[model samples]
Each structure stands twice: as structure tokens, then as C-alpha cells.
Target: MPLPPDIRHGGNKACYSPMLDYVKLPTPEAFESSEDYYSTTFHEMIHSTGHASRVGRKGILEPSYFGSHEYSKEELVAEMGAAFLCGYAGIEQRTIGNSAAYIAGWLKALKNDKTLLIHAAAQAQHASDYILNRKRGEGEQIDEPIA
Candidate 1:
């Protein structure tokens, strides 16, 4: 006898993709926790930032051309952007389990570019600034600890 349908799959909708929507990113509500929801949404949003209609990352978003330079660069942007936001918001970093896969993908796109990390770090800074600015209201300064 076959196991229950739920048992066949994890039923955990936290992997950042919709059932019939491979092209579209997962929505925030589809996630179980706010952290997962927000992080996933933020990742996709950062990717969308590169959209040609917007930030001009359309070349990378295409599924057929996976792991190309454009795709790798954008992943760097999204990955670092996620890290920055998680840090800035005082949230725990999400587990990126497929380390080997990510490294391979990035390395392939970069052709093992020595400065890839440096460029990614810079883009992460911009992404962080943008997100912070979006949430900040005029004249609402963040409080710093007294030195």
C-alpha cells in the first residue's frame, strides 16, 4: 500500500516556490513562519529588483539560462541581501543547506572570479540600505548605544 499523500512530500511550503508557478516566486502567506515568509519574499523581491523593467536583471531570471553570469551575480545579490536584512533586523540566518550546490553555481558564473565576494558584499550593502530606507520614516533616526 502507498503512504498518505502528505507523507510522500514534506507538505512544508517553505522552499520558496509555488505549486504550479515555477516562474513566479512564492508569496509571503504560503510560509509557516513570518521569518521564512519574509526572508523568502525578500529574496524574490531582491531578484525582481534586477528585473529589466526595474533593476534590469531579466537575463538572470530566465530559467533556461540557469547558472549564467547574470544568474550568478543576481544570486549573490539576493543571498547577501538576505543576510544583511537578517542581521539588521536581528533575525537568525536561515540555513543554506546546499552549500556545495550554491558554491558550484556561483563559481561557474563567476569563472572563479577572485573578486566575486567583494562585488557581492558591495551589492549587499546597497540592498541593505534600500530595505532600511524603505522601512524608515523621515527624521526617524535609529538609536545608537551610548559610547
Candidate 2:
């Protein structure tokens, strides 16, 4: 929710703070394109959705170290959720490739468990739905292709 100054001189990452219930992302200038900026914001939004006050995903509620199973799974969900949002907004074409590479990196950390994508995708759909203010059984359709 807040585009705060980067901690590092030119960091290009973002984060969601559960304690403060907010997202902190670098400025738009840090990204190569507007699509990249929005995609990164969406990724952090998905992470925020996992907060205890929202969808209550354990990966976010619990403290999971980097590269841990929970951490990897959560990263996959956030990236996939961002991809879904990008597709819905008709901007996936600009960010899909980066999303795929990001997801692939997390998958590798998860030991390349193909099944995790399925599971993560389901959660991603839920996160995107929540973010979009859609209710369950309303319309589980995605009009745009994710990749």
C-alpha cells in the first residue's frame, strides 16, 4: 500500500509487512516498465492477502526462513497470483515471461515438484479472487491466457 524508499540504494524488490498490515515497494522508476511495476506490486498484494487478517495462509502467518518449503510455496503463490492479476488486466503479455522465470526459480527451490504448481495455482486463484473482491462460485473463469 506504500511505495516507500528502498532500503538499499537501488533495490528492486518489495515486501509485505504483516505487523503493519501494509506493503512496501520501491518506486516505479526502479522497474523497467509500468507493467513490471504493477506486476511487482501485485506480487506483494498477494502476500498481503495471506496475512492472518485475510486469507490466513500459514506461509505468511508463520515465520518461515528463506529457501524453506513454506517460503518457496508462498513465493510461488504470490508470483502466480500476480500473473493471474496481470492476465486479468490484459498486461500479462508484458510480464508473463518474467513471471514464469520467477516461478521457475521458486519451483527449483521446491525440488521441481510439478504438483506444487497445481496447488500453488489454486491458492493463487483464491488470492486473486480475494483481491478482486470476487466471491466463491461467482465465476471461476479467467478470460485471459496466463502465459
Candidate 3:
């Protein structure tokens, strides 16, 4: 059988390309450093949350358009989702020493739009809950992601 994400320490992830042309997150896997893996996955998860079956974010799930409002909102959602997910996952915050630039960029995006953070946070929470609940078989909807 294929390795499970828990065993590989990877979270359900899509192989995402930051460029707007295409983005795809690989399925989650188990890794030794699951917190990082999960954090990254949470970013993607938050985007996928826009799917019709998920949070219904509409148009935001498409590839990120640089300097675009919708893209920035989705990025904020992913960032906030990852942070919140880490909390929900029980992983204490740690510095990989690579987040400063990312944090700054996200902050700028948030500054551009006052509601970006809040909306993304709320969406992240919903996405995180859906993932966790579906993982434990608490809900049946997540198993079928939107097309």
C-alpha cells in the first residue's frame, strides 16, 4: 500500500507552483518533521478550501495572479490557516529562519486589504476543521473534493 501521510510525516498536500500558470499540491505524506510539512500543506489546504464542496471561495482557488486582490486574499488565508492549523495541531511555533520574507510579503498583502486576514483566518478555520473532521471520519463531504 502507498505510504500514509502520518507515517511519512507529510500532510495532504498538492504540488503547488507559485506562478499563475499552474499549481498542484501532492497528496499528504508522513514525514519526520510533520509540523513543517503540515504548515505548508495547510497553506494549500486553505486554497483548496475554496472549492465548491469546501468553503466555496469562488475564483480565489484559481492560480494566484500576482498583484491581484483575490490572489492576495487567498495567500493570506493560506498563511493564517497554516498558523491556526499549527495551533490546532498542537505544534508550538518555531523559526525555520526562512519565514521573515514570507511574513513581510503577507503583511504587505494584508495591509493592502483590511479584511484579508480576517476572511482568510475564518476560511482557514473552516478548512482546518473540515480536514480534521474528515480525517477522523466525522464528516463525509471532504472525502470528495471539488473538481
Candidate 4:
């Protein structure tokens, strides 16, 4: 996807472009291990779940600049979502600590607003469920805001 991001160094960062509806990931060789590659890929996939065609998340549809509050929140969701997916696949042990630390760093930067974690966890669960193709019952309510 996205030409394996810069054919040379193979992009250091993976991203999901909402406008283009594509996930840009680096080559597996660029990562320390296959697990790292898959974890990063899972993160981008979670970002894709926010596309309007999928979950219609405002943060994705509305377009926020990098480092914005919306962007940060969406990143948090993606990180947690990736963690959930990794756990489901029984590969989280290698990445969950990093994910938690990443989230904690963001939380600290955001002044440790406790509710942010709660909201992000809920949104991440929903996004992870979506990616796994798990549908809720017609009356079941699991639609949490993306930001």
C-alpha cells in the first residue's frame, strides 16, 4: 500500500490517509522484527477504521493537522486499537508495554486528563471490533466518538 512508502528507506512512519483512503506502511525489513511490522500495520489499519465509509469518525472526516488535539486523540485510539488486535492474536506481550507507554506519554502531555483514556479506550475497542468485522446487534449501542 502507498508504494511501500518511499521505496528507498521505506518510510519511518506509517499513516492512513483519509482523503486517499489508503494505508501507507513501511517494508517489513524496515522494522526490527515481523511483530513490529505487523503491530505498526495494525495501527494504520485502525486509523483506516475511522474513514467515513467505515465508522465515520469526525476526527478523520473533518481533517486535523498533525499534532492537533484531534490528531493526538486519533493516534491514541489507533495505538490502543492496535494493542487490542495484537492481544487478540496473542502477540501483545511484545508491544503492549510500548503502546501503554506511548499512551501514557500522550496523557502526560495532555495534562493527564483521565477521561481521555476512558474515551480513547472505548473508541479503540469499537474501532478494533470494526476492523475484526464484528457487528453489533441492531439495538446495541457501541458508537463512541473518535475524539
Over 1-147, each residue of candidate 1 has an lDDT whose tens digit, in order, gives: 011011112343432222222224345455666776556555654544443333333333355345666567767677667666766665644524333345456767787678777776665555455545543358843221101
Number of residue pairs clashing in candidate 2, backbone atoms closer than 3 angstroms, sequence gap of 3 or more or interchain = 0
* lDDT (Cα, tens digit) per residue for candidate 4, span 46-99: 888787667657668787877777788888888999999999888998887788
Error of 3 at 14 (Å): 5.8
Q: Which structure among the candidates has the greatest TM-score?
A: 4
How does each model score on TM-score? 0.55, 0.83, 0.60, 0.84
Sorted by TM-score, highest first, which candidate order results?
Answer: 4, 2, 3, 1
Q: Each candidate's lDDT (Cα)?
A: 0.49, 0.80, 0.54, 0.76
Q: What is the per-residue lDDT of model 2 for residues 94-135, given as tens digits with 9 covering 90 to 100? A: 999999999989988997575887888888998888788776
RMSD per candidate (Å) reads 11.6, 6.3, 7.3, 4.2
Error of 1 at 50 (Å): 2.7
| Per-residue lDDT of 54 in model 3 | 48
TM-score of 4: 0.84
**Clashes in model 4: which pairs?**
none
lDDT (Cα) of model 3 = 0.54
Q: So what's the TM-score on candidate 3?
A: 0.60
